[model samples]
Target: MTLAIPDLPAVLETDRLIIRSPQPGDGPDLFDAVVDALADLRQFPASLPWAMEMPSVDESESFCVAGSESFQARKDFPFLFIDKTSRIVVGAGGLHRPRWTVPAFELGFWGRSSFVGRGLFSEAADALVNFAFASFDAKRVEAICDDLNVRSIRVCERIGMQLEGVLRQERRAPDGSLRNTRIYSKCE
Candidate 1:
């Protein structure tokens, strides 16, 4: 069964980061982070279609507003990862594609270019996994990424997610070539 929105915490904290639902004024920070990481994000265009074009400030604002609405509606949970020390948005990610019947969630994340080498993304992902299990009683949490995304694979592995399988030729890459997808999961 789906849990009430009020039962979920608006903010999830890790040792060095704060993962929180998008708020109205978060657009500028989000935009900065996205732009800083645009090249890396666009490398997997099919999986990140939104990164194909540069986003305007207004578009970013709208995205944040929609994220807030979606969170309230229990449609999706999009979050921004903020560094506790610098108070900068280091990345954005969330548990999406909810399967309430099975109590499952798909975790996704991307870090700002400047923050790519840090362990913050992995920390945030681990926290999200715990939140899904503890708050939603989720039976499973999964992460899917392009097979060539080594960084993402490392993040999944670092968080103790097991590689379930690789879906061969699952979709097309930006260059019109077949792309494989790696599926990783952590079960409660």
Candidate 2:
């Protein structure tokens, strides 16, 4: 089952990064990151539907505000992966589709193209998974990605998430192609 609490910590830190929830006035920076990563992100249309449009600053801010409210209400927790030293949003990810009865959540993440292959997503995942168990009654945490996304699959493996199996032709890509989904999970 999924669980959340208003008093839960907003920021989670690892050795090299700080993962924090959405805050007000984050639109400009958030918008820039999306704009910078648009090209690469476009390749996976199924990820963030809002991101596919390359939203304006106002739109991005609106998104952040909604996210903040969910976090505050203990609905969902979508966090920003911030580089400790550079203070940039290297990537973002979070636990979603919470099943409170089972205390389970699905993990999703993406990173700036420039920071690709740096293991940032893995670091973020490690922290988020720990946060889930420590902050709530998380019995199982999952990370599912397009089967063809080798990078994301690697992130799952790097974080020690075991591959359950691939769901063949499970999703449709932005290019209108049927894609398989790889389901990975980490259980407590």
Candidate 3:
């Protein structure tokens, strides 16, 4: 079952980017970002499920619909990352909840191929972490990245998340190989 989070302001403008709730109209743009970023994203096992299936516009629409509902239910909030200058959806970011652990949440994010190495992910992450702590009064915010995804690991570290530990072979990549997951966290 999918969970929902309360909807907030439609757009969150950073100095260089706008983070906002995605609309059905954003389906095609988001789909393109996902496809374009596939190779870079495949490095992270968390996104392995979508690596093979290049989603259609309908599938992307379903994603936005689910995201909208999830926001309304106070479950999770998935926002499209838009470049302020271009006003284009360049990536995605959000929070995830494990029902067993209410109130505390996990952070998830990914950027398009062109957005990498530009530090937007870290900026967006810091914003989301701040939101989780302030808006939700969350006791803890966490993130996990594949060991091989050095860029993501660096993003997490850049945002002040401490390396808690590494879970050896906890995840299997799309390539059918076991991989280590680096766990990181920031506390309230």
lDDT by residue for model 1 over 59-114, one digit each (tens)?
Answer: 98899999999998888988899999999999999999999888899999999989
Ranking the candidates on lDDT from highest down gives 1, 2, 3
Model 2, residue 186: what's the lDDT?
94
lDDT of 2 by residue, 47-143 (tens): 5555678689999788789889988877888898889999988878889988888789999888888888787888899889888887876999999
User: What lDDT would candidate 1 get against the real structure?
Assistant: 0.92
Against the reference, the lDDT scores of all candidates come to 0.92, 0.83, 0.80
Error of 1 at 116 (Å): 1.0
Q: Give TM-scores for every candidate, taking all chains together and pairing residue i with residue i.
A: 0.96, 0.93, 0.90
lDDT of 3: 0.80
What is the TM-score (0 to 1) of candidate 2?
0.93
lDDT: worst 10-residue window of model 3: 1-10
Task: Please report the TM-score between candidate 1 and the true structure.
Answer: 0.96
Backbone clash pairs in model 1 (N, Cα, C under 3 Å; residues 3+ apart or in different chains), count: 0
Ten contiguous residues minimizing lDDT sum, candidate 1: 1-10
**What tens-digit string does per-residue lDDT give for candidate 3 at 146-187?**
888888789899999999999998887767888888889998
TM-score, ranked from best to worst? 1, 2, 3
